[model samples]
Structures are given as structure tokens and as C-alpha cells.
Target: MAESNKHLPRLLCLHGGGTSAMIFKIQTRRLQWALRSTFKFVFVDGPFTSGAGPGVLPAFAGCDPYFRWLNPESQTAEQDQRRVRQLLSKVIKDDGGEFVGVLGFSQGARLTAGLLADQEEQNAAEGMPNWKFGVMLCGSFPPLSLSFAKMPSTKPSQGTDEHGETREPDEDEIIHVPSVLVRGTLDPHGEKGRRLVKYFDPETAIAMVFKMGHHLPGAAGDTTSDKGDTQKIVDAILKVYADHLPYEELKAPKTTVMENRNGQLSA
Candidate 1:
């Protein structure tokens, strides 16, 4: 029986390059009810174009300037965050209560980190969410990390690697929290993404590798593996998040209460 306030957490999900929030319709449903309303999934699209279907939104398709994650374009970061915050204002504003965190996939992950950088500002004359935590999926960040630092107002410069080769900027300064990063062993971005955990709260940043590629397997919200799947990925993550909550039981929600039950949620 679903309780009155048995709603899910307000999760701000960012999409990958050339993608939008619609792609998740098929993937996040499994969590809809089982999460006991503790998972308020919010989907946000990137401000760019990609060949993937469901297509990129108009707002992103025409960006004059852009860098697909790993490139610390702070302007891109702020714009994207502002866009997400605006969209979320409808559902999550008025402090709708229980902002579990922002979850980003691929390029979305990079944006997620940027969003945090925006919120942690000491002089937040700007409106950045004082969020709870963040999750990165198959993504990493670059440095000189200021959410709006690279914005057109004060565009950030590209960085260089140790070898004097102009590389992407350092991503270390972008985040400040206990974050969890998920990657697939077979995923190309695995190693580098895992390192981001160190940049965030080392005590809280955790990484998980699946026997998969860039995306998690599923027709829609299902984790399917030809051999087998570690459906435990989501639960395991929620488990580790047990103690770090900053909100009260009524005001702030804890993910632990939302159990995966038999280790798997049903449609």
C-alpha cells in the first residue's frame, strides 16, 4: 500500500550528448512504484545535437558554443544548469522536498558535476540548488571547475596536460559532496570516470563497473545481461548512501527506506 507522502525522491537526471530526457521513459519505470514514491525522477536534456533518435531539443540543437563533457566549458555548464533549474522549478521548486540528488549520464554526468560547482558557491547571489548529493554515470569532469566560470561572461580557458600538450582543464574543483559514480567495465570511459570519485568527497564517492558498454542494458528500465545482471547496482548505491543525509525524516528523505525488495523491481 502506497502511503500518502510515499512519493519518490526528486531526482534531477541529465541526459547524454545529442540526447534528451525522453530516453529514460523506458529505463526508469522499474523504479516508479517500487521506490515507493521515494524516487521523483527529473529528466533534463543536453544543449547539443547528436544522431541518436528522440532527437535533441531545440534549445540545445543551436548552441553557438559547446564541448561534449571533459571539456570544461563553464559557460556551457552554467547555461545547462540554469536550464535544468528552470525546468525543475515547476516540480521541485517551492522546495517540493526531498531532492535526492542529480544523476547524469555521459555528457549529462559532466553537467551534473558542473551543477554542484554552481550550488557550492560561497556567494550564491546566483540561484543554485542547495542539493543533497549527486550521481555520475559513465562520465567525468575537467578542472578550473566553476559552474558559471566558463559562462560567456567569464569564459574559462582550456587546460593542458602534464606533457605541455593542451589538454582539457582540471575537473577537481567542480564538486563538493559524497557522490557515487557508475561505469561499465567494458565502457570506454570507465577508468577516468572512476578517478572523479577522488575529486569529490573520497569518503562518499564510489564507483561500480558492469559487464557492459556505455549504456546500462534494458529495453526499458530493465537491466538485462545475456549472461546475467547485477541488478544490485542501484540498491548497492542506495545502501552506501545510508548515513550521509542532511535532511530530516519528513523534510529530507533517505534512500535506504526505498528497498529493491527481491533485489529486482517489477513493471
Candidate 2:
């Protein structure tokens, strides 16, 4: 796709729980073009196998297997933390272009929040620079609570390494990033979902909600919504990128007129 702004920051799109990277394109396509010519979008599937989510697994359209970070164990925050850390590492490394921030939905939104939190931590460790952009939709926090591990087998599986030592991820680690969290008021998980945003420091965290549901909330076909929705989310992300970009040097794309049977702006 044509990039809107050459200097616009790259926004890595992440998918939510019960979803694959495919769900992102539909909502982001217009926003990608509208956000300035250089702005970029890239979507990533999570790191968990879909066997965990039933029918949702095959939705990857027969691509290679995938992975996700979910509540794997009960009575321990380790499982959630470990999985998020792994995910954060992957997103950073997978960032082929400049990673200004991230955008995600449902389970993806949870990850986006996690990534933003992690980024904030990074900035703090590296001496605080403005980090945190991108967007999230529906769902919130760890998609579902990791504190509620449903599987008796949810504990990290013991697998053999070349040396055969138990190769489970380290627990005690925390992944924190600074970013936005959006939720639909009517979503089953929406109210509690706000907790997702509270995990971040108020100075860094920006939370918003809509009267909508589990999906990205917005007016049926408008560019933005008073309630949380993809367009509003993307706009927030762009504002973050533009804040970093040379406003005068990076020009937003000008509207181009399409010719119908006659050369006229379609009304």
C-alpha cells in the first residue's frame, strides 16, 4: 500500500485474542492512507498456538503456526509476566521498520497495552524519552485474566532442550510499556477492562472508552468516534508520531480527486 508520510512513524498492528493478523486490515486500511503519506502499518500474529483457543486457531488462513501470551498458570503472576516478556522481545525484534508504537484489538489490545508498558520501562531504564503510541481496541488487559488459568495443564509445559534441562521461561520478570487502552462500555469484559489501563502510571497511561462493544467502537462509517474506535485510536497514534516528526517537513497527504464519467469531485 502507498505510505502516507515518508517520515511518519511505523505502527505495528497486533491482533487480539481469538483473532489473527487478518482482522486488522479492514479497520486500518483507510486510516493508513488518511494518516499522512509516510505513515506505515504492519500487522503481526501473536506467539501462542491457536490450539488453545479452539476454532480460532484455523483463522490464520493456514499460515505457519502461531503463539500468544495468555494466563497459563494460577496463583502465580509469573506465567503472565513471562509470556508478555517473550512477546515484547519478539515485537521489538520483529520491528523491521521504525517502531513508533503499536495498534491492536481484543487480545491484541491487551498486548498493545503490555508493549506500551514495556516501552515505558525501557525509556525509564534508558533515561526517559517519550515512548508510547499506537492504539488498542475492545478487550483490555491480558484479554482474559491470567489469574484465571482454565487449564489444569496451563502451567508451562516441561520440554526437553538439547541438554534436557526443564526449559520453561523465567517467572519474576515484568513487561511494562506506555500506551493507550480502549474499551467498549457494553463489552462483557469492558468495565473490569479499565483495570488494564490502571496498571500503568497515570502520568504515562491514557485511557478511553466507548458506549460500544467487544469490537473497535465507532460511528457506523464515520472517520472518528466519541467513543473508543479504530479511527480515534489511529488518530491518537498518529498524533504521537507527528509529535516526533518534523511537522513542517512531513506533509499529510492531500486529497486527490477521482474522475468518474466526468472530471468532477464526486458528491
Candidate 3:
């Protein structure tokens, strides 16, 4: 028989900082299974190698060769956004699929927010495709505007803040895309996640605050409630998908399916 769900819309999966695509795939295995009929999840690695991130050890130990999307110590925010733009362009071009949305955790979540901002404020003018939605899980920090102005040489830190402890989003940075923003109550970045919510249009945003740390729902030593929490996220994603993309268009064979690209660890 022919593939049953060949027309499922694609949703890109971006791993958190200090993690690899393989690890994220493993981390989100249950979630993928939950949404298997609704979406085809594509996992990709970040470009920069780095040490493991918070809440990654003791369980995901030996899962070496971790990676990050940006290195604040070396690259300016402007430089990092450029690299991220190139990385995304390459991924989208290579997949050749209908990218309906993206799902990201932690640092990846921050990048997802920035990706939405850039798509709206910059890339759309260049004919780049727009994601129908975004899913940010345990995200921290406000996103860097890809169109940030050049910093003056005399005051190199004029337009960006590498360590923005309580940074706020500018009016133009408020994303209008439908999004599911997940937050863990016990996470250190929980407050930041709250701040991040203001960066999205409240009308199109869904906030899910759970009682856990800075990790995906049902990850590691999560409680029995994990399954329920995970289901909430799944429901939210489905709702966003339904609200953003029309059912007929989602069923369109020309754009819903990927070309020859199998979901792999693309960097």
C-alpha cells in the first residue's frame, strides 16, 4: 500500500544548548510518538560544539559532542544571528518540505523565538518562507532581533546585551505567529520564560506552566503527571496547527511532504 500519511506537515525540531540532534530525538521520542499522526518531526543539530548544558548530566552522560547555536563569549549577537539565518536557510532548502512550524527547547527555544522574529521583520521581505507556528519549551532570555543595528565602535555594547538578566522585548520584536510556550515552575529560567511570553502576541500565544525544572515534560525523573503535561503540549501544538494552517492546504501533496530528505541529524 502507499504511505498512509505522506502529507503530514513538517515540524522542525531544534535541540537545546549542549545537546545533539541524536540526544534530542531520544529526549522527544515519546512526544514524537504522541504526535506521529499529525506531524513529521525533523531533528537537526546546532553548529557550535560546547560543553553540556544545565540538567543534561547524570542521565544523558557520555552523550558527547554536544553543541550550541551561539557562543556569546566569542561572537556578537549580530554575528550569531547571521550564522543562525544561514543555518536555517540551508536546513529549509535541503529538506524541501512544507515547514509548518518548529519545536525547540531551552537555547533552541530562544533561537526559535528569534527565528520567528526574523521571519516576520526581515526574511519575509526576501521571499523566505514563514513558519505557521512555533513551540518553545522551557525557553529563557528574550530573542535577539536579526535586524539589530550595528554597534558603535566607541560603545561596542550599544545595541546588544550578551548577558541580559532582565532584558525586555522592543515593540517590533513582538512575534505575531501562533506559539505554544511551555514553562517549568521549578526551572531557574522560569522567570525569564515569563518575560519571554511578552515577546509574543497574546492573542495567538498559549502559555503552559508546569511544575518541573528546566527540561522537557516527562524527561529524566519526571513525575507521573509527565504524561498529562506532555499531552497538554501535544494538544496545544495541534491547536496552533489548526488555527494557523488551513486543512486543505495542509493536505496539499505539493507542499506538505518532504522531498528526498529523511529526518536526520542535519547540522
The lDDT ranking, best first, is: 3, 1, 2
Q: Which stretches in model 3 have alpha-carbon errors above 4 Å?
A: 1-6, 124-128, 148-163, 224-226, 247-267
Count of backbone clashes for each model? Answer: 22, 25, 0
Best by the lDDT measure: 3
The residue ranges of model 1 lying beyond 4 angstroms of the native Cα positions read 1-6, 31-36, 47-50, 53-91, 94-97, 123-125, 143-146, 150-174, 217-230, 246-267
- Candidate 3 lDDT over residue span 223-250, tens digit each: 7235677876777777777776577744
Please identify which of the two predictions, 1 or 2, would achieve the higher TM-score against the true structure: 1
Model 2 lDDT per residue over 1-267, tens place: 444344455667776554556555654555665564555676666655554332243344454354455543336565655555555446656654566666777667665654444443342212112344646666454323222223124446466443222333233222334445666556676654655555544443445655565555442343334433455555555444454457696543322212244211221
User: Which ranges in model 2 have alpha carbons more than 4 Å from their true place?
Assistant: 2-8, 36-38, 51-67, 71-95, 123-131, 142-178, 201-205, 218-231, 243-267
lDDT, model 2: 0.50
**Whole-model Cα lDDT per candidate?**
0.52, 0.50, 0.73
Model 1, 1-267: lDDT tens digits are: 334543656677776665556664334444443444456666644444445422233434543233232323444555554554455555455546566677777767766776666566552214345666777777754322333444423535465344222333345354556566766666666555655545565445555555566665442322534323334445544554544644454342233221133323222
What's the lDDT for residue 32 in model 3? 87
lDDT of 1 at 229: 36
